[model samples]
Target: MKALTTYIISQTKLPEVSVKNTIELLNEDCTIPFISRYRKERTGNLDEVQIGDIVKFKEQFEALEKRKIAILKALEEQGVLTPELKQKIEATLDLTTLEDLYLPYKKSRKTKAETARQHGLEPLAKIIMSQNANDVESIAFKYVKGEIASVEDALEGARHIISEWINERTDIRNNIRQQLERFAMISTKVVKTKADDENAQKFRDYFDWEESLSRIPSHRLLAILRAESEGFIKTKIQIDDDKALDKIESRIIRSNNECSEQIQIAIQDAYKRLLLPSLSNEALQIAKTKADESAISVFAKNLKQLLLGSPLGEKRILAIDPGFRSGCKLVCLDAQGGLLYNETIYPHPPQNDSMGAIKKISSLTEAYKIEAIAIGNGTASRETEAIIRKIHFKNEIQVFVVSEAGASIYSASKIARDEFPNYDVTVRGSVSIGRRLQDPLAELVKIDAKSIGVGQYQHDVDQTKLKKELDVVVESCVNAVGVNINTASASLLSYVSGIGPKLAENMVSYRDENGAFTSRNDIKKVPRLGGKAFEQGAAFLRIKEAKNPLDDSAVHPERYDLVKQMAKDLGKSVQDLIGNAETLKKIDLKKYCTESVGLPTLQDIIKELEKPGLDIREQAKVFTFNQNIKKINDLHEGQLLPGIVNNITNFGCFVDVGIKESGLIHVSNLSDGFVKDVNEHVSLHQQIIVKVLEVDVPRKRIQLKLHT
Candidate 1:
């Protein structure tokens, strides 16, 4: 374990104890699910994110070790093995770094070195490099009688040979590569032909931008690179090779001699012809790789926040997909997300019926005892909110504007069709818009996450890699917040660790064959859901009205016996001891210690007993706004306007006010006082209330004040 820890830390740039602690816990034969959930004490309470990092680090370390062994064996076979070389190879972390060390020994392309060796010019080139020769061109004449005809040809041939010798020097190439990477500037220019392309327009702003290779933001770099690849722009890294070569040559050759100029020329030519392209390629690739990694990390962060966005809990909600020219689509769903009502209201249309629409909404709110009204933050949303707010309902209800980011995509999806076959697309969309607010997990599974628009550059990223990463994230989130076994749809159930589509369907089939799961143990009867599967997934599958309360909580069944043992030690039945607060208080759970169970596990158990199937919801919840106030002229100084944060740049944030336009809240207007980064003040999806400070109706833009 210590050896593995050293290896992982050295190879992965991870801390030593992180790997050591992780491997030690894994050696105890705890499952990923178990270690992540119950063995928090052993793993230092490392969350799923940290555990996943450890897993990746371990895999990469092992793979690198295998590669190192292969490289060492191959080098030993070539009979160039040295203790120093072996140590350097073993110590190297990056594959590129190791490859840099081994480039001299690696197989080559057609080069002047092989040609010179064939023509017998290597000895002459060597003589010239040694600077022992009075004149290199004169010395080369001795070997140039038959093949090298003229002094010019012989010098040219010998120069090629000497240049190849210079190129083969790994130290020189490595030094030059390092220098170029540090000083190069990444410059992108928009291609002139495609300036009018719709996608090209977004990148037009970046076409003429320049940034140092080291400092460009990952998002902007990727966006620019993607635009260039799509033929909307052209990009290149500009480096002054003359300046770079001068520094390198001066550092390498300190002595002033007649042969120094020749050597310097050879070095410069070798760099320009042989080493620069490969090194620039490497540097660019590294830059791109770092950018890609940063973007993915940001994407993962945003996605986790978006996916775990507060679930409103199970509630009957009336959804309104608002439209102006067309009528508003109204959908009402039961607490379990089953659609109960579908109707349309022409509040503002050819057959405008504002009062009639109000009456219909009022009637449904009263008849269904609607708990909330979910209004889509699209067209006519604020008008619908206004109308719904005016209606007097016998039942108390709250109105929320739900983000309809992927609601349209879900409505047009095959799953949506299967769920709502008789309804029109608009009605299905309205229901999805509502259900997303009621339970984000259950409804979100129906739509592709990339379409949800929470991530930047999700579409342009490596699709397979993105899907694998996002699927893991979704699964982690779904299981972390345990699912309701009986009510969860197959789409939702498939996200469970061990339950794929077929198994999810089988579980549902088994339930249909028998009845609702009365106990967590009954899940074993479901075909393909064997003991190992149960061990991984059972803890996250909650059974409402189950025989054991612990089963509904995140407590694994293996620990059930331990809980019972605790109850026995307390001279009370397990059921009585679980809810018996007085007895539980008296019992020191640290006394029930095992190799796996500790303070964290015992405390989790006590908390679970308090609320067996607690669904933690967000507090002080806010909703999305559909209306936009585009122009500053259209708003009074004190008017409060609902706005969507469109773009967050260095200066300020741009918000889309519903007038088919947008407004900017300058950095000064962002607060009562000073602000640094716009991202610190607002995020991409945040819906904020802004006061209109200044209006430019001619430009169709508004200046907003966020302070008040």
Candidate 2:
């Protein structure tokens, strides 16, 4: 445990106390968001990302320890647990090193070497390995009894065993692994049968691609792997075979003798029959894992940005899930996102009722006092927006094109069905679009993060790992922007610090039965929500109109007394001090700091007092796309057009330029200067102007350069 802590601290470069405290909290089953937000004092004010790193490194060290234990036990059971070998295993921290040390003793299916050992040719094999024997055939002849018929057969068996021995050497395996890492190239070729297939054309860029494994971009690697998985391409890791053999020979071949020549043969055999194939696959897997992590990181970042996107706040929004033949599904949502009304309108082709649709929108806006209109960016979206634009209501309504990526999926989900059981999918979807405009994080939590479509290679990455990372991101975002306990749905509440799905459902059920929570303490009445859960969650759960003003702020209940004391010392009520920035600034944070509540927490409390329940996200602004350019065909070279950065990748970012086919602003074009990270220049949902560089209509590919 101490070693683990030291390793984590070294890796994270975090204070030892904070790392230890974080590890303890994690061991106590605290969520990352909980520790990051409420336990800031214990963790030295580490944010969610730093806390998450500590958790990740701690888990990795624990996994390594578990592997160590398993390896030790296996070696002990096999009666090969020599003190020196055990010391080596115990001392090594690298998993690959430990595995290599264990490889010789691991039981496996009978191979050529195992068969040779069974033929009582162990002595001959050792003699060749020593590389000190002259006239090795004579030495091999001595072992030509029983299953070994002749000197030639004896030498063959000896070489087989020697090859296995060479394959199992720890130094040999490590050296070869290093070689593969430094010099290997990932090469891909189109499958012969799929060469002319239309489906394979998507991967034609990789048909004869070869690049150093270490230098390949994560997106390209994932694409190649996905193409290979779909049977459109064949991929392999390539290395200089002679160079690899020479490396092994230099390590194993120590002398020039009859046995040295045989040892050379075994080296080649070991590499060909075992090491090359095994290490190639291992290198590829390591590369893939790295690529997955990179891709998942990008996905997580994009998800965070999208989830924390500018919310329109509590507004009466009229949302439309636009369609042509099926008409537009429209829903009116009140300030709290409660569905007030829903209907269908056709202002588009096949069943155009433009006047009726315009009249209906105006009437609904006037009746419901709608402040905003959220139109789904789907089929007939721009047309619907144009129609709505023509409707001159009594009040100016803010119109927005909401990315309806996962609205349909959420609408059809069980949660959606439960939320609007009487309504159909279209109505539910429209409500989602409207609610998203009001609160993206709250509504997005109800849908799977991947389905939200702000990612690259989301489906191709490891699902379990992707979910874990995304869950962390969601939890961070949810806790970052505190949840409204009285109004938050189960899906949104589930992401709150310590609240899981069950606790969320219980809270919702309790809210339903007991009415809106009047105080933070009221949360404890919910079933199965114990003291610890309340402690971890209460600060992040906002109780609007609560008796205690602090209940509506980020300041925890435990610190309510301290704040009250501060107010009392000031000869004022807590409510009087709340949001009083002048009063907050007058309070000496250092004077309030204690052993557990340090300057960081006290400062945070002070900040919270100045702006009670302040949301960190910005307000959603209205963006206009180039109305003249609706399709890819309308785009011409050097044309400047407004676009939204929908997705960002390591290589570049994909921009939605008012078309079905998004344009790629490659990283090189992101800035006039050398650009390393695409995110540094652009982010998900960022509105920017891009100049069309090239367009391939057949491929539906658009090349765009950022309008600097």
Candidate 3:
């Protein structure tokens, strides 16, 4: 345990006490958001990222220890556990080194070496290995028995045993691994059968490509590997064969005699049959794991930005899922996102009933008091927008084109089915588009993160790892903005600090049976919700119109008495202290600091009082695309257009320029100077102007340069 603590501290470069405290908190089953937000004093105010690192490293070290125990037990059962071997295994932290040490003792199927030993050639093999045998042929002749027909046969058997011995040597394996890591090249070739397939055209760039394994970017690696998985290309890791052989020969050969000649044969066999294949696979696996981590990190970052994008607040929205031949599915949602009405309008092709659609829209807008219109950016979306614009509404209504990337997926999900048992998929989808404009975080939590489509190669990365990383991001975002206790659905509440799916269901069920929660303390009455759950989750759950205004803010329930005392000290009520910026500015944070609540927590409390239950997210604004250029063919070179950054990767960002196909803004064109990271230049959903550099009509590719 001490060694594990030391290792985590060294890897994270964090204070030892803080690491230890975080480990203790995690061991006590506290979630990362809980520890980061509430347990600031114990963790030295380490944020969620730092705490997440601690958790990851601790899990890795624990897994390594488990492997060590299994290896030790195996060696003991095999009756080969010497004190020296056991000590080496116990003291080493590197998994590769430990595996190398245990290779000789590991059980395997019968091999050439075992066959030679079974035929009574062990003595002859040892004599040759000593490198002191003169007249090795005569020495080998003496060991001729069953399976050993002549002097040549005996010598061949001896060589085979020596080859296996060299392969198992710890020094030899380690040296070969290092060489492969430093000089290996990854190369890919298109499979002949798949060369002409249309599906394989996307990987043409990698069909005849070679790059240094250590220097290839994460995206390229994932792309090539994905192509290989789909049978479009074959990949191989290559190193200089001569250099590798020379290094191994130098380590094994110590003399220049007949015995040395035999050893050289063994070395060649070892290099070809054992070391190269094993280490090349190891190197590729290492590279693949690294690529997976990088891709998952990128996905998590993009997902965080997209989930926390600006919200339209609680507005009465009229959402439309537009289609050409099928007309448009429209639904009206109240301020809290409850579906008040739904119907279809044929403002587009086939049934172009423009007058009827306009009358229906205007009457519905006035009947439900619609404040905004959210139109899905799909087929006939532009025509639908034009129809809505043509209508003269009684009042000003803002119209927004919302991305409908995963609305269909959400509508077909079981959660959606349960939410709207009587509504069809179209109605549910329109409702999703409306609610997304209202609050992206709340609505997005109900769908799978992968369905949101902000990721790169999301389906190809490690699924378990990607899911874990994305779940953490969602949790962080949810807790960052906080959830309304009375209005939050089971899906949104499930992401709060310590509450999970079961508890979330329980809370909703409890709410349905009783009325709305009037205070944060009332949440404890839910079945199976204990003291610890309340302590971890109470701060992130907001209750509007509560008796104590602190219940609606981020201030934890544990600090309520302290806040009351502060208000009493100021000779004012709690309500008077809250939202009174002048009074809050005069309070000395140092005077309120305690052993558990430091200056950081005190400052946070003061900020919370200044604006209780404040949202950090910006309000959503209306964006206009180039009305004249609605399709790809309409674009020309050097034409400046308005676009929104839809996705970001290591290479560049893809911007939606109000067309079916998005344009690529390469990293080189992101800025006037060197741009190391594309994210530093633009974020997901950021509106910017770009100039069309070139357009490949045949390939449907658009090259764009960002304008400052």
On lDDT, the candidate that comes out on top is: 3
Error at 692, model 3, angstroms? 0.7
Q: For model 3, what is the alpha-carbon lDDT of residue 162?
A: 92
Give lDDT per model, in order: 0.75, 0.90, 0.92
lDDT of 2 at 125: 86
The order of the candidates by lDDT, greatest first, is 3, 2, 1
Q: Name the lDDT value of residue 238 in candidate 1.
A: 65
Worst 10 residues of 1 by lDDT: 624-633
Error of 1 at 207 (Å): 3.9
> How well is each residue in 1-708 modelled by candidate 2, as lDDT tens digits?
699889998888999999999888988888887777667889888987898889889888888889999999999998989999989988887888888898989899989998998999888889888888899887787887887889989898889999998899878888888888999999998889999998888889999999999888888999999999999999989799998899889988899989999889988999999998999999998998999999999999999999999999999999999999999998999999999999998888887899999999999999999999999999888888888878888988899999999998999999999999999999999999999999999999999998988888899999999999999899889999999998999999998888889999999999999889999988999999999899889999998888899999999899999998899888899999987888877887787878878887788888898899999999999999998987889998999999999989888999998878899999888998998777889989999999999999988999999997
Clashing pairs in 3: none
In lDDT terms, how accurate is model 1?
A: 0.75
lDDT of 1 by residue, 428-510 (tens): 89999888888877788777877877656777777766776677777877877788989888888888866778889898888
User: Mind giving the per-residue lDDT tens digits that candidate 3 earns over 156-191?
Assistant: 888899988988998888888888789999999999
Estimate TM-scores for all models.
0.85, 0.97, 0.97
TM-score for candidate 1, please give it: 0.85
Off by over 4 Å in 2: 145-150
RMSD (CA, Å), each prediction:
4.2, 1.6, 1.5
Of the pair 1 and 3, which is ahead by lDDT?
3
